[model samples]
Target: MRKRIALLAACGLLAIGTAAVPANAAEPVFPLVGPSALELPLPVDGSGAREQRLSITLDHPATGAPFAGLFTVDLRKVAGVATVRDHASDSSHQCTEKDGELLCAYKGLPVSLELDVAAAKGAAKGATGEITVTGKVPGATVTPLTTKVSVGGPDLVMREMKLKKDLRPGESQPMPLVFANEGTQAAKGVVLELGTTRGMELVETYDNCRTRTAGDLTTVLCSVEGDFVPGAAYELAGDSPLHIKATAHAYDDVLRYGIYPAGDEPKAAASSGKARAGRKLGVSPAKSAPAAPGLRASDLNPGDNRREFAFHTENTADFTTSPVSLKGKAGDTLSTAFVFENKGPAWIHAANPADSLARTVVVVPEGAKVTGKPQECLAVDADGTKRAEQLGAPRYECALGNRVSENEKVVYPFDLLIEKVVEDAKGSVTVGDWGTSAPRPHAFDPNAGDNTAAVVINAKGGTGTGPSPSPSTSGSPSPTPSASVSASASASPTAKASTAGTGTTAQGGNLASTGSTVGPIAVGAAALVAAGGALYVAVRRRGVRG
Candidate 1:
């Protein structure tokens, strides 16, 4: 019994010792300490093109003799066109697994990974993929650290734009274009290029606080005068639209170049692998589409019992038609029809009967002629410009009365008799009329006219005489408001002018000497305007009319 008891005691002691000695499981293992995380650079505010880097500099969690060799790090996946290039040291050979961590003692093995990101111009802006870094332990499982690759901070931004479409040949309109920078850094250089449709020419270009007329063809290009700072907006007013081809190319002189840095050396161009081919990477501007055109004017004829007096006008809100084009040539006299629309605000005040009439002009080529009394509603200037009197003029007033409410607009339509004549003529239709009341700011772009309808005139075919000649009418025509004029009523001048017979006179009225009341000059001005319309109308008719 004593021997058995001694043997049992020895066996129990040996078992306890073995348990305390610990198996391989109790030994510290390399790379088993914790998961790895990443840090990324982003913008304080959201704007501009994004370019950023992914940073990795976290500490390892575990330490042990088994983690004595090198490890590998790589990106697991990438979407879109993003790519990793010039990778940091691929292997960590000199790493030491000591204490409770894995440490790379030399710079040859990168402690952090850096990469240059360049989103393609058409590339989507956002996180493109994930990166995984794995640390290997000679006798233990490989540990992986994962992070997301994100894009942030923009380089350039578009602020505002004034673009127009569907311009007629030889036509030009003005636009106000604006730009800005929303990045943390300054932009070095900027340039704007002029593009036109195939048949259109850039009539004029203006910038830098100046009135636009004709631009110097030689120096038509525009460039930024100074470096642009973040959050700064630049404006280029007086840019005009031209009638040209649809596939025409309009872009910056040089789309992109080098960027200025905040401090340190400027970042170099991205590697071939970093560049993407089809990504949209920047903010664009918003714009409005073009308005539809007017109907043809000279198509009015008295066919059978139905009388069709067709007249067209461009860029006007409303119009009224008369049988004038068919008057003398019509075999039968029937009622005419008119079509029109009111484009501006519903509120506008006008006293003239024609103010409610929609007017239209049938452009007569310089040589065309008509037979019957040109439509009674049609008014002509000394030079030959045709004005439709039946169609009331558009009223654009600030306030219904003297108060500033909403901007106002009104459209007028008219009807006229169709006249027939025989003569070679060409012309375009003028749709809108100048109001008797003071002129207001034009609501739409000048070149983006409402509609231009082409017309043909013939005495035998039922067309009105081209247009009437200047009237011997009296009283000053309403004046067109200027840019200098203020929209507010308080800004209106308190002066008044009344004309007595031909002699000059000055009285208590605050009417300052405006200028001469040369009636013929005004008539000539209207005629010249009519002639321009005639030319455009003839061009379109070549395809639609015989």
Candidate 2:
């Protein structure tokens, strides 16, 4: 019976001992997970210094054991001076075990440590400090991780610009620049300045730009429109290439909040706006085209309201060469051909007198002397009324055939006959004016009267036996021909054949009398008429529109 009783007691004692093992262990236990250590980073002497405080508390430091005594705290500086009071301290507290956990009987507030660093008035270099805690709970181990306090001033480093070269005139190109805060200090009041070249114009915000001129450099104030965080790069784009420089600044307190920490790498220069100056602006060049030629009419018949004789001009060395010359004994026939081109966007109608575009250039050929009444065509007034008349029986009436488009050419033939001339001691044949006469009614149209040529030949004659000059009026008998003339005394002119427009021939080829209006109805009617005419021609030719 005694032996069994002893065995039961031993079993009970073993269980109780196992339970109390952790409660009675001697170990220093922190009331919080982190220590109450104070750390002061490098301090300046005069100016205000930034302050940072870290509060660490552990809810349950004595998990299962009593906190004994002898806890140690350590302060260290990674780059700057780290000062502290009572970095290592210890306190003894009587603890008790309840349930399975060891609890402190008296829990006093943590020991207080005051820390202050000196600050200087002027700029100072950067630095950092660290604080760590090493302590123990009864029968257990505890080591708190280190906390850091960084210190420094504003760090200025330029970054890339987002502008490209080849900017065109009157066009705005966006420019972007990035900057970084690499120091322990947080940058504020950063200013970026841009300078203008000769042709550059700044975009105004309020009708004008706020500018400050500093000797050779002009600084324009531009706002930093966006925010940038510490250790983070900020980018901004502006109007275009006008040289710019960027710097960083801030209000006093920075390091305490751990801004732009040390060990931050400097951004590469390639990321800076300074590199963009090497890029150039771009533009496209201009090109030119060739020139056109010059030409004019050689001669025209005013009487028949006919087409003028045109002559293409060649390169002239001098202005003296005679374009036309005429010499005729009392009676003779003069024939000449006028070469012409259509030079037109619209087709010419030879049959339509109202549509005819003819100007007369009468030429008296060189060496040809003419004698007798020279005929003339009376020009109608602006009212389309005539005022003068022609002499004895009209001789030649002519109008050139229809002209083609500018791509085509046409030619007209002319003939004139000489009627009479009075013999003079000088042997000169005088061409008399036979068309213009007072007290006589004028002809209504250009073809009604004789239209004389502009040039008249009066000198003796040329060596070769060429065609003789024609008389202006060929109705009467001509003078007797002398041996010197060697040509017939009577003259005759014939007209040439032509093919142009054969429409309802309503007095055509007359610009002044056309009297046409450009009204919508007229245009529509003309279009319909043209369409019908085209359809009729197509049908007559047995052709289809497609």
Candidate 3:
């Protein structure tokens, strides 16, 4: 097939693709994902830390083509900016650099190439150079990617915040989202993004920002157009400082904040909040400046762009499933549903929108065959093995995405065809984490006994199972999050650790988002979402639930 490659630049990044090809012999176009611009730290720290990694990923991570990593990379450096170091390894295969290029030979299919890039010594701030990578795939030719390697760019760093201890529910406080451009050049524009746990809500919405929310977490992305000069510190203007409020049903929660160069922030997933009609979030010069007298290039690294803090509120949420009655004759097809509700003194959110708040595990009654199941449900045996067929398994695990508002209810309907009716054949409707099949207690719930409810099919003698519904649905104490949060494709973002002098916690991390020292949900819950887990599910969840 005749192939072509195109390198288009946008938003300080490269969108690598190809032009039109004849329909008959043409394969679908794939993009080469990598940085269009790589920044090296300015040598203001007195020691030379010139090594950085350039990761070049092909199309996407899912494509497991055999020859994906066996290609070659033609490296052409600007000579004075940086140099490519030898990175041959023995695990997959030997990779070698010869004649200003790399033969990336590998026995296994690796999605990306992590090459060592060492900046030239005495590299001053604002020094511009280039490392152009030309990849040669087995079948189709890949475009040569030119990454602008500069000595310094704007490094927007957030300030470490001292969270208030002993925060009570329903209390609102102003949080100053402060950051500064600590590099050689001015940032053309700035984007500030924040993520909050289920128990907390961003009190104000701005016109320049778009908020995407799921279970207990809400993410806000704001775009502010104006140059942020180096050496000058900034804070969200006093009148427009970000305000956070703990819901009446608040429990352990978190707040994450980061600032990126104009359009360099991570992209958000679909189904987010629309920009509101409020005033745009603006920044003002900070009252207190950095301890240093003048600006040097200490904060040019991208690793320290974001941070998070876990908070605690004394609260509880009672999660329970409703007793559902299902019936059908031997040859009858029946559709029935059971309801799941959060009886809150606190609401539950998958603070990371990508994480699952909980799961609705259904063990179908004997003598019944599942014809149609809820979307994003898995067909597995009692021990959670993948069934050969997508249906008719003894067990089905349906995901409930990360957001479950207090007093909110979700109904999962299943269509089953009865092969035979067993009088009072009982199945279970329980909640389980990603790791185990046995139902267990939620981290924030005080009442642990009632999470699982009985699904009585064709009860001849009238079965009395499951905890009865709470007396009333009105006025239940709750945390933040929506009334009805359906499952959606959710994802857990990876969090970066904090270095000295900057603020921002990690993303989509285990043992990290729960809390610093104490919080309601443990690291296991985050692991279930990030590592393990919809009609309403993201790729992260699809892998886990399926």
Using lDDT, rank the candidates from best to worst: 3, 1, 2
Q: Lowest-scoring 10 consecutive residues by lDDT in candidate 1?
A: 537-546
Query: lDDT values of the candidates?
Result: 0.28, 0.27, 0.58
> 1-546 in candidate 2: lDDT tens per residue?
224323423423111111122343564333323222222322435435544333333323324543343334454343234333321222333433333222332233332222233222232343445655433444443434454444444443454344433332344444444445433344333434344322233343321123444322233433232223235555443332333211111001000001111212111211232212222221111122122121111001112111111111111110000122334454454433222222222232223434423333223243322221112222333232442532222222212222222212222222334454322112111111122322111121212222222233332444212242332222112222221111222323211112222111111211112221110011000000111111000000011110
Candidate 2, superposed: residue stretches over 4 Å from native: 1-45, 59-70, 76-80, 85-129, 148-150, 153-235, 239-546
Best by TM-score: 3
Candidate achieving higher lDDT, 2 or 3: 3
User: What are the per-residue Cα lDDT tens digits for candidate 3 across 395-488?
Assistant: 8776666665565544454555678878888787886454475657777777766678776667776432221122112111222222222221
Residues 1-546, candidate 1: write the lDDT tens digits.
224323423323111101122235754333211112111223334543334343333233423222243434443354442444433444433433343233443243223334433333343434455545455434444345454444322244433333454432234444344455444334444434332212233344334211111211111223334454445655543233321221111111111111121111111211111212222222122333222222111101111111111111122222211122212232221111111122321112233423432233443333323221112234354343444542222211111111110111111112222333335333344444443432222333132244344343443454443222222122223333221111111212211122211212111111122433111111100101111112100000001100
Task: List TM-score per model, in order.
Answer: 0.21, 0.20, 0.55
Off by over 4 Å in 1: 1-154, 205-221, 237-546
**TM-score quality measure for candidate 2:** 0.20
Candidate 2: count of backbone clashes, pairs at least 3 residues apart or interchain? 52
